[model samples]
Each structure stands twice: as C-alpha cells, then as structure tokens.
Target: MLAKIIQEGLLNHGFHILETRTIQYGTQIRLLEGAIINVYRTPKVLVQGKSISASPEQLRKNLEYVLPTRITVWNLM
Candidate 1:
C-alpha cells in the first residue's frame, strides 16, 4: 500500500515512470530519463549525479523535498 501511494504521488508530481527493477537488495523505481529511486530499509533517490536520502515521513510528502537534476549523461555507442 505504501508503494502504491508513493507511485501515485510521484505520478501526480509529473514524474514519468520508466521501469521498475528488482534486485537482491530492494526495489528501484526508475523515473524520467535516468532518475533512479532506491527504496530499501531507507529511501535514497539518485538523480543526475547526486543522491537524496529520504525518511518515511519525507516520502509521504510526495517527494517534495527531492530536487532532481537533468539526465544529461548518455551512452553514445
């Protein structure tokens, strides 16, 4: 239920849901371009080149505290 709420909140905030990746550690919610959110025992979102560590209360706030940067780095192969 918490995940659903967070997903909905992110959606409302104009954050494009790219894909979800699951690993041995936890779940990663991929967002616009390269923004990746790691939600494990604690929540840490990686955007641009920085990572924002968030609390449960902060997560409930629709990620208002997270200020993500653009995904400028790309693979030109």
Candidate 2:
C-alpha cells in the first residue's frame, strides 16, 4: 500500500516507478547502518541497543510487550 502510494505520488509528479512490491511479516526487525530499506516491522522484536529507533510500530510493539500493564494499556489504544 505504501509503495503504491509512493509510486502514484511519483507518477503524479511526472516521475516513473519501475517496480512496486509489498512485504508483510510477524516479527520485528531493525535496519542496519547502510541498508536504508524498510517495509514494516513486526510485534516480536525486542529493542535495547543504542540505535533503538527503527520504526514506530516496532518500538510500540516492544514497549507493549516489555512494559508494565499500566503503561502498555494506554498506548495500546
């Protein structure tokens, strides 16, 4: 869906999109230093390293899994 949006946006701006694809997963993953590609993050990845910011979804999922019930309950909404 995001790729389609991006491609359509590019086409609207007179740019061409050579390809489009989508990836769905059920596990959390992080981006490395040089790899700048990301589709989505899952709900099972733990984040405790220095470069903790991967994506909002990944961060929220981890927080909900590790945090106390009080904190997790609010963000879940």
Candidate 3:
C-alpha cells in the first residue's frame, strides 16, 4: 500500500523507477538517480543515497507527503 503510493508519487515527480523488488520484509525501489527507497511493512521507510539529500524540491515534497508527522533523520556520514 505505502509502496504503491510512493511509486506513484515519485513517478509523478518525474523520477524514473529503475527497478522494484519484493524483499523479505517489504519492497525495495531503485531510482535512476541513485536513490533507493525501502518501504517496510512496519510503517517504516528507509531512504538512502547521496542524491536524496540534494534531490529536487518536488522529490522532498513527495517524501514529506508520505511521511508521518514525526520524522527522524540520521546523518549516516
């Protein structure tokens, strides 16, 4: 459910979906710009990639649209 919403949101934001795989826990979506989105069944989403931080405004907006009010950002540097 969440995965489908995210896929549609990203696509509407002009992001090209490179690949999609159903993992053991949930769905993994790979984007052309090197961004990987992992939507887990536990209502937790893990977004990784250098491009994510520097992505366009619309991309960020799409993320915010799906995210809950409480968000935790970790600087995995």
Candidate 4:
C-alpha cells in the first residue's frame, strides 16, 4: 500500500522517485525514510474518530476516573 501510494502520488504530480535509500542510524532506531520506513512506523498515534458514548471506559483507563456504569462516551472527534 505504501509503495502504491508513493507511486501514485509521484505519477499524479509528474514527479518520479528514481532513487530510494535505506536510512538507518543504529540499533536504537532513530529515523528511517523511504525504503527504510518499512522497518519503523511513520505514525506515532492513530486517531480515527472520537465520540462521547464510551467515555466511561476511556476515562477509566486514561484518567483512572470512575464513571457510572450507564454512562459511555463514544468516539466523536
């Protein structure tokens, strides 16, 4: 999927990536780009949506706050 996305993007913009590099610093994993990105995730957090219907569970896990059993906060963001 990543390769397809890059290929399509380059094609759409009339720009070609004639070269790819594997960027690796050390075993600690500092940064990776292009071909090297396959080794590490490019995103830190994945946020899809937010809601207020499941807040009780979320708050309980996140803030350790107690919420009534009947209350929930679904992802709505």
Candidate 5:
C-alpha cells in the first residue's frame, strides 16, 4: 500500500520514527522532534467547505497524495 511505501521511504531518509500507532481513523507515525505524520485509512478531504471521505483504495485513485521533506502544496484544478 502507499502508506507502507511512505513509511519505508521515511525510514530510508533517516527519519527517527518514535512510534507507529493506529487510532480510530487511521495510522499515525510519530517522529522525533515533535513531528507527526498521519496516513488516514480513510481520508477525509475538505474542498470548498465540502467534506469528502473515502476508503484508502478509493482515495488512492481519486487523489494524488505526496509527502516530502519540504512542504509544497498545489491546488490542482
């Protein structure tokens, strides 16, 4: 799954992961230095004040999600 790929990717990049735990919504990876990453099992996205929630498989197809060391977000139209 994409989540596992990201987990491995972060591990390869020298991220000190404090914990990997599952909450009610999804899995959360706690890193050192008070940073946390959430890979939602079911991602809920809000676009233009509308809530859109879906399963991982569904979101994977409809969304293009990425995680990088530097934050860069683009609103694709």
Candidate 6:
C-alpha cells in the first residue's frame, strides 16, 4: 500500500527503481541514488542513504509528501 505509493511517486519523479524485495520486516525499495526505503509491516518507514538530504528539493518534497508520519531518515555519508 504505502510502499506502492512511494514507489510510484519516485518513479513519477524520475527516480530509478533499482530493486524491490521483501525482507523479514517488510518491503524494501532500492533506488538508483543508493537510497533504500524500508516499509515495515508496522506501518513504519526507514529511508537511508548518503544523498537523501542532498537530493533535489523536488525529490525531497516528494518524499516528505509521500511518506507517512512514522518515518525515519538516515544519512549514511
């Protein structure tokens, strides 16, 4: 549900979808920018990457709009 929405949002915004797989917790979406978005079964989302904060404003806003309240962002620079 949420994961699918995020995926579509990213795709519509021109972010390449590298891969999508199911993990122990939930669904994981990998983007071309080396970012990984984990959508947990508990309705939590974890976004990790070095370039997340450094990404374009539109991309950042898109993420902010698409992601839910239970979200965590990690900058792995």
Q: Pick the candidate with the highest lDDT.
A: 6
Scored by TM-score, the top model is 6
Per-residue CA lDDT of model 3 for 1-77, tens digit only, reads 98898888778867789999999898988877666777888877777654644555545455566444353232111
Looking at model 1, the pairs that clash are: none
What's the lDDT for all of these models?
A: 0.47, 0.33, 0.68, 0.29, 0.47, 0.73
Writing each residue's lDDT as its tens digit, candidate 2 over 1-77 gives 43344334435544333333343542222223111122333322222322233454554453344333331122211
lDDT of 5 by residue, 11-50 (tens): 7765566787775676766655344556655543211111
Q: Global CA lDDT of candidate 3, please?
A: 0.68
TM per candidate comes to 0.48, 0.27, 0.70, 0.26, 0.52, 0.72
Question: Which is the better candidate, 1 or 2, if ranked by lDDT?
Answer: 1
- Winner on TM-score between 3 and 5 is 3
Q: Summing lDDT over every window of 10 consecutive residues in candidate 4, give the lowest-scoring window.
A: 27-36
The candidate 6 region of ten consecutive residues with least summed lDDT is 50-59
Alpha carbon lDDT of residue 76, candidate 2? 17
Instruction: For residue 54, give model 3's deviation from the true position in Å.
Output: 5.0
Residue ranges of candidate 1 with Cα displaced over 4 Å = 42-77
How should the candidates be ordered by TM-score, best one leading?
Answer: 6, 3, 5, 1, 2, 4
Off by over 4 Å in 3: 52-77
Candidate 5 residues lying further than 4 Å off, grouped into runs, are 43-77
Evaluate residue 71 in candidate 4 and report its C-alpha lDDT on the 0 to 100 scale.
29
Candidate 2 runs further than 4 Å off: 23-38, 41-77
**Poorest 10 consecutive residues of model 3 by lDDT?**
68-77
lDDT of 4 by residue, 1-77 (tens): 33344345434543333444443421111111111112113412111233233443442343212212232232223
| Cα lDDT tens digits for candidate 6, 2-76 | 789888877887788889999987899988766778988777888766555355554455567656755656444
lDDT of 1: 0.47
Task: Note the residue pairs that clash in candidate 5.
Answer: none
